[model samples]
Target chain A: MVYLHDGSFEGILSGIYKMFHAKAKIDEGKLYEASVYQQSFFELTLNVETERENAHRVASSIYESFGHEGFKYVYYAYLAEDDSYGTLLFRSLKQAYKIGHQAFDALGVEDIRLLTQMANKVSRESHLLLGLLRFVKLENGIYYAPFEPTQNVISILAQHFEERLADQVWVIHDTKRGIGAFYDKTQYHLAPLNSFESLQYARDEVAFQSLWKDYVKHIAIEARRNLPLQRQHMPKKYWQFLTEMK
Target chain B: MEIYEKLRILADAAKYDVSCSSSGHQRGNANKQLGSTAAAGICHSWSEDGRCISLLKILYTNQCIYNCAYCVNRSSNDVKRAAFTPEEVVSLTINFYRRNYIEGLFLSSGIIKSPNHTMEQLIEVVKKLRTREGFNGYIHLKGIPGADESLINEAGLYVDRMSYNLELPTTKGLRLLAPDKERKQIIMPMQQVRDQMIAHRDMKKHLKSTPSFIPAGQSTQMIVGATDETDYHIIKIAEAMYRRLALKRVYYSAFVPGSTHPAVVERGRPPLNREHRIYQADWLLRFYGFKADEILTPDQPQLDLLLDPKCQWALNHMAYFPMEVNRVSYGALLRIPGIGVTSARRIVNARRFSALAYDDLKGIGVVLKRAKYFITCNGKYCGDGDVEPVYLRQKLLEPPKPEQLTLYQTHPEVFDESEATIRGLLT
Candidate 1:
């Protein structure tokens, strides 16, 4: 049986809480977008309200079975925003919980190692995006930027950019999940920027674009010309909004 | 502060000095500090040049007294110059660090006023970072060539790493191009720091309370292709730096052809592949148990610009190839062109489990393309068993002739004898 829950981290947690309370040994892979799973199997559209107490218990269970770091490992991996990560994380957490805290120490084992490695990948990707995110100066004296990060770490990235560009009003739109953060001098939040494309990007965006393009061209030396090396360092897919490319 | 303008200028100037590896100092935030530096090093970001920008790699000042002809920020260049106050640098380091943008600082500077004066400013920046700011991050401070030994020692106490760039590779090149600087002016200060570090370790062994100097050790940068000094000369200097001074690294910066010095060859820059080959050669000397003289001689001193130093060495000594993968010694496995430290270790470990098959060689991380040319699996020749040195070399050189390769594949042509013969014809 497959359980379709609202695509929210808390909602997914609540589903896990319900499964545990119901004593259901449902496979982690059972959750699908309705098309892929077996048709005759039981399907539940879970609307379990996100209980703080249940979330805490679930977190506590993982910590008790693993450790404090293990809890954070699962949390950040969940924050990775990849749907596939959910099943992998769930399976790992379930297996670890079943075996207790001793299983956490067996990190060299492949299954547990995979989760730890995934967590590290998400953490590193989040850190790299901190420097790579390009902010364009908008016409209204605001800085606007967009990113399609593979992990749900846009908020963590926004905090650093916000501090660095504190003087300006800006918005960073995470185009993939339609969520973003807007900072107007003193405040910021992860809000739905669904209509961000229509929301006018400032006029000076063109000037900043030219400046960055000029910077990249002049800085990349011809004597040490290595485009394949450059691509290996900064992949081409990242060039769409990087002012250096345009 | 005008330091912002200076920061851009000096940081840009310091960018090409490639000794910026930030490994080997791991300290945790012990005093309730917000962040800590790792011993294995951390790369926060890579710059547009595709080089890792882990530290705040900037010059304390670009104001130099020495006019090194190959340097862009040579005193003669009428460029916008700037200097950072020690306080300003401290704040910038902390602010950038708090935001997790950088691991720490890589503070180098031109000879601002005098070597002692410049060394003082460098020391002051680190003093404030370590003592005043409560910062325990990895700092790599460049020692001024003519700085006072005491000042250099003081600077060493606060920094994680220190370097004095041997701007040109050879003494003759140093005289012809960078006339104002002498070889001793650089090496003397490095020797002082290294001796002090060793003395500190000895003191610590006796007196438990003794402090260390530059825990990550010292590294130096040599500007490649700036003078007539060949790869053999460059690697010789590197080996000397490691053996004599105990330098942790010897960075090779490929000279960009902007200098109008008469001694410089202006027809075309020495290929980046040449610099890459030198670095590979340097690694072989430092870690892979090869000597500078063994890699190249004064007669055949320059590295073959097409094949890596290891592969080039392997080619010259073809009798060592086709060794049994399961039985070859760890040191011998490292000499194989396709085998690295990682694969060598894997081969050593996996051999205990089972006699490795041809398929198992792939799992052990051998470059099948390169290793097949060198090794045999259980006496089964994976590559052409006869190992014609001419035919083998051609296959290796053909891949990147259309487009240049990375620092890793710098001298792809050096891999094959036929390619070398072809190139000799064209030249």
Candidate 2:
């Protein structure tokens, strides 16, 4: 059935919950049935509004039957946010309900395989940003890091630095999404950040940046300098924010 | 000297080091410390030379008493010299770490007055970083070759990883290139650190309060192509180090020509290809269960410049060709040229549901371009034409040779500043 949910996580889940019991409850609603599993069709599209209640039921079904591993795949895929990602969540959730945990290992299935790839792409970005994301100390003793990650991975990056850099107050701004994560030494919270104001660097920031640039230059072995390999690890899209690249 | 000059000189002195890994410790921010070590490690940046800038890799000082000819900081050379105070190193590590420019600090030093004194100077920095600053980040300390055992052990308690460079592969290479360092002098501290790590593991089993002893274990590096050591010799040494000493890693650094010392060799270009081939074999030894003798023999003492060790082995043993992927054991699946650890595991897992075909292989992560030469699907051979070794060898292409490009990270005049004319290669 074509059950279109609002693109939110809860809406996606509500859509999946309605799809699973399509034959019974979905027939009376404004929804229209489509082929399930392995290439779904859209004869009709019905927006799902039973969001929170249905979202809770599907989430518990995933946790109870397939364990946390299956939910990780769904959540990361959701974060990846492709154009038809909602339909992907619905199809993979159907896989979880039918085959239970085996759905994860069933890489032969196209939807499951794509979900795995999307989740992996999200994870790879999260891991890369852990190192690539640079923080510039502002004039007021606040460390602010600005980045443009393709995937919505602020949650992952925030949790890592919150524990790793526990004693400092910092802000991680996702400029592309207009959102920011603010951590106040003890805890962190996320809020909308449409645009950023021009901030001055700390007094010693320029001197340290010069020292850092020299270190990066001198540490490279002249015999093995391969810019292609360096670019392969640190791509062109993320160069504007890097202190060394600048 | 200013921190700028000190950093430039010390970092240039330390660039020959190939150990840039910052992993192996899961130490967290205890009592709300300034930093924590990630278990898988993180690379904060990559230099233009295409190597990882994981840590603030630098030397405490570039002033050396012993003249190691292959080293730029050798006493015989008149290069610029500088050193950082213990306070300077602590502050640099904290500031760079806070800016997310580096994961931690990799501190090594030239023998200041003596081996014990240099080791002590290195330890004092880490001691302050850990205790005073409450830094729980990754640390890779250089273990002075002939330092006292007590000092080496105590340094282990403060750092996550320790390494003593086996500067040259064989004793003959040490005599030829770095005459001041003896093979035994380097091995002593490595052995001491290994024994301490073993004792720490056993002690921790009984008492939970036992502090970590180099929880990342010990790793070593050797200069390749500077002297005429065979790939066979280097691989065997690395294999023995892993088996006997329980070392975590062994790095191979291609010698870069940057000194005027008479002992330095390979004046034209670094033998990066030879270094690359040896690393290919090193991975096979560490993960692929291949022995040193299996990779290279006295009959063919060097690795093939064109073929990888695994593909070379596969070509040699054609009897194992055209193996059915679905039926083969996981070990055999790994032996195939295109199937890696991940692809092999995927094939094994996916086959449980149904047999994989050539199309399924690509999705599951097999390099069909290479694997099609050796593997079969569903009792059908998908290899192009006959799987003859000679034809397959011709089909494989090689990477760009090193002679085409120069490693001029800066302009060529960067060398003119030193005026330390390396022999005929770069005149």
Candidate 3:
């Protein structure tokens, strides 16, 4: 039997909860929103609606039974937008339920390896974005930064910026996702911000940006120009929002 | 001059220092502060030259009294000079930091009036940033040679890291290039910083709220390819400083000829390849647990440009190779070519469940092309027949084709065979 989810973490967890209760031989499953679902057919297709209570129970069970590391791998793997990741996590969680924490120790298993790989990619992209995200001061004294990360990493990256820039009001908008993590001086919340027209940068923002561009240009030693190495560290995909790159 | 012009002049003068790391300091933000430092530093941007820009690296003033022959800001040189006031420095640091352009400020200076006066001016900017501005970001202050010990101690309280550049590795080289500077003057302040850090750590063990002192520890820079000092001499000094002074890092800057001094001008531009080799050897010393003498012997005073220090060491000690991957310890795994600290740890972790084959080693992060010659999986060798040292050296040192280079340049994500083979050997 195959189950489908609405491409959300809760939806995926609800599918896992149903799969656990049914105890039927599962063939394959995926996010219904993915384009691949339209080309293929399955015998039984149940649309798993997101259930908050069932999702919470499965999340807590994963943590309680397999430990935090296993839960982290599943969570980060779900955040990875790979189409195969949903099925990979479902199978991995089933194995986790049976073997407990030792499921991750079975490196020979294909599902376990793919789950770890997807999670690693998500974690790597999030960490890189933490360093590459640039902010500009707005006229209202709030710092506004925009990033289009490859993964759904805004939720993770927001916590880092909150601790580092605690005194300032800021917004980290994921342009691709159309969602922004807004941080007032005290707390942070996520909201959709489709339009960027509301941002009014400070008058001296241009001057400060020029100063930074000048500093970056002068700081680089002219004799040792390596474009390949530069691109290796700061990939071309992240050049859009970088003030120095502009 | 305008502030932007001053920034260009001062940053250009300060570019040769090459210490841009903002790590090791874990400064949490106070209630009203605007910034904080992570335990592991963040690189805000990388320049075209592939250097990390973690700090607002600039000099407070470029007007100097000392006539250092190799320095761009030497008093005799006919170049533009500029100085920033304490207020201007503080403003630029906080503003640049807020815009996410830099992690913090790395403030160095040329001797404007005296060592004490210049040190005091640097301290004032940091003091104002911490106390009045409530900025809790990383700050790396340069210690002036011959400055009073009390002044150095005072500056240590405000900054995260401090350094006194030992521009020349040997004392004789110091006298030739920078006649006014002495080796003792530089080493004295480093010793003071080290001792104070030890005392602070001891105090923190007993008291819950002992304020941090130089929480990031001290680092120093040495100009490579300037003097006639061999790699042997330089690495010896670095190793000794790491052991004796408890220095966090020892940066190496290749000497760029900026002055018309006969000694510097005669030896054109410094070879960057030599500097790169030293950095690789330095990594082996710090992280790979290799010693100075082990990297270079008395007969061979320099590193091999063809192969990296690690590969060269592995080739020299061929008897240790062809070990089973599933049974080797983590320390022994690190000594293998194409196996770094990360891959070694991964191999140790992944091997607990199932034995790793040559193909499995690739997934575990080990670069198999290079490791094929050095390692085995379940007592099976995957390398080509005839494991001769001369043949392996030639195979590793062969250069890649231009088309392959361009392919790697265009699509860096796609693994080019030649580039990976070379990187596996070099890095």
Candidate 4:
């Protein structure tokens, strides 16, 4: 059997809720996003609509029974963009509910191991982007930064910038997906980007960027130039948004 | 001078002082403040040499009043010198921070006029950034030796971390290389910062509103290989500093040939590997329960460049090897060469449910190739048949060659799980 739902955390949770209520054997079941569903022979596809109450029940059960760490694994795993992330999370959650919070300690379990690895990838990407994301000052005095992270991590990255840059108006745009987190001093909200038009930078933006680039160049000692080490730390994938790299 | 020229010269001069961390402070943003600091520091970029660019590490001025044999900014050295005004420093910090270029400022300076005067100028930059501009970012200041106790104490209230460079490890080295600076001058301010931090913590027990005093604690830098001090001597001093002064970090800088003085010119550039070994031994002192004496003895004064200190220590103490992985405590697990703090915890927690096999150790984040010689899981060992010290040393000395990438595979990020595991084990 195949279950389909909208590509949201709530949709996945509701699917899990329906799976349990129907008492269906999940050994041969597969989960897929509604937007990318593909039918196969002898597979029964069931569309699961997101129900707020059911999603809340599953989320609260996981939080109350498995503790915060368990919820964190689920949260990060949901952000992973892999095709099999849903099935992986489902299998892990099934084991976690049986063994309680100790399920995370079961690194030997294959399902739990795969779930944590996916979660770790999402978290690692978010942390790296936190440092790699560079903001430019827009002409209207707002800081605008755009990035293309492999994982869907804008929601995680937004909370960090909201706290660190509290007094500034900023927008952290995920260019791959047409969405961004807009912050205006007091509040932050996620909104869809209408267009990918680049903003006009402030007059002194070029000067400050040049100064930063110059500092980066001068700070390195020529006698100890390790391009491989530098590339290892700041990967080429992140160099696109870094001003000094340009 | 233009700000661009000042930045180039000052940054070039400051590149040698390598304390780029902006961690250990957790300051939340205020209503009107422009920034905040996270407890775990954030690196904005990486330089070509692979050092983290966490703060805008720059010198306020490169003009000195004394001649030090090993310093590039010494009075006798012929180098371009520039000084940034208090306003200039403030503007640069705010502008860079606003654009997310750096965490904050790491402001160090050479003595322009006098110790007190230089300390005052450095304080002025931080004070203006905090009060006038309302910027609450991480600031690491260099505490000038021989500066007044009052100035050092006042500066600590505004900054997150401070350091007084112990240019050379021993007093004799200081006397020979930097005659103007004395051991007493450097130790006095470090003692002051340590005492003030203690007093502030005591006061905070009674009063809830006592402001922070060097919230990130103090660190000091020691130039290795310049003075004939052995690794044992350097690690002993660092251990004492950590135990007595409550130091946050003891940075070991390899002596690079910068000064053209006859004394410095005689000593060629020190190998960077020596500096790397000192750092590994320093880590054993800080995080792991290993002591300086345990890492290196009087007879074995130098660290083995080919093998890590922990692995070397394990090879020396072969009697304690082949311990049961499931039975050892967390501390004992850390003494293993390949098991770090994180993996040790993972092992301890994961083993509660079932016995860990040799293959299970890898999933728990242990480096099997290194730990195989030292640990056994469920009475099964996968290491070589002959665990002799000489043979094991020969086997471990062969560093793994870098794997060639294929056309489809891309270079992995530094924080990739495998890289992070290797770094955690080594560091």
Best of the candidates, TM-score = 4
Task: Using DockQ as the measure, name the better of candidate 2 and candidate 3.
Answer: 2
Instruction: Give me the runs in candidate 2 sitting further than 4 Å from their true place.
Output: A23-42, B399-427
- For this target, which candidate reaches the highest lDDT against the unseen true structure? 4
- Write model 3 residue lDDT over B1-427, tens digit each, in one string: 8999999999999988889899997777658468889888888899888988999999999999998888999898999999999999999999988877889999999998889999999999999999998888899999999999999889999999999999899999999999989999999999999999999899999996987899999999998887788998889899998999999999998887656686564556667888999999998889889899999987899888878888898888999988789998988998988788888877887787678887888765577768888888989998887678888887667485456456656876667776789899999
Task: Give the lDDT of residue A43 in candidate 2.
Answer: 48
Itemize residue pairs with steric clashes in candidate 4: none
Return model 4's CA RMSD, one decimal. 8.2
- Sliding window of 10 residues with minimal summed lDDT for model 1 chain B: B28-37
Query: Which DockQ values do the candidates obtain, in the order shown?
Result: 0.12, 0.71, 0.56, 0.58
lDDT of 4 at A156: 88
**Candidate 1 residue-wise lDDT, A69-184, digit = tens:** 77767777766655555456656666667656655433434355566666767787776676566665555766667878777887776765555445457688888889879987
What residue pairs clash in candidate 3, if any at all?
Answer: none
Q: In order, how many clashes per candidate?
A: 12, 2, 0, 0
Q: Lowest lDDT 10-mer window, candidate 4 chain B?
A: B406-415
Model 2 steric clash pairs: A1-A34, A225-B49
lDDT of each: 0.72, 0.85, 0.86, 0.88
* Model 4 C-alpha lDDT per residue in residues B1-427, reported as the tens digit of each score: 9999999999998998989998998998758458888898889899998888989989999999989898999998999989999998899899999888999999999998899999999999999998888888899999999899999989998999999998899999999999999999999899999999999999999999999899999999999877788999999999999999989999989888756687764555457988998899999999899999999999999999889999999999999988789898989999998888888888988888788998888876677778888888888777877899999988777577899976336744544877779989999
What i-RMS does each candidate reach, in Å? Answer: 6.9, 1.2, 1.8, 1.4
Off by over 4 Å in 3: A24-36, A65-68, A96-108, B30-32, B398-427
Question: Candidate 1: what lDDT?
Answer: 0.72
Please give the lDDT score at residue B90 for candidate 2: 94
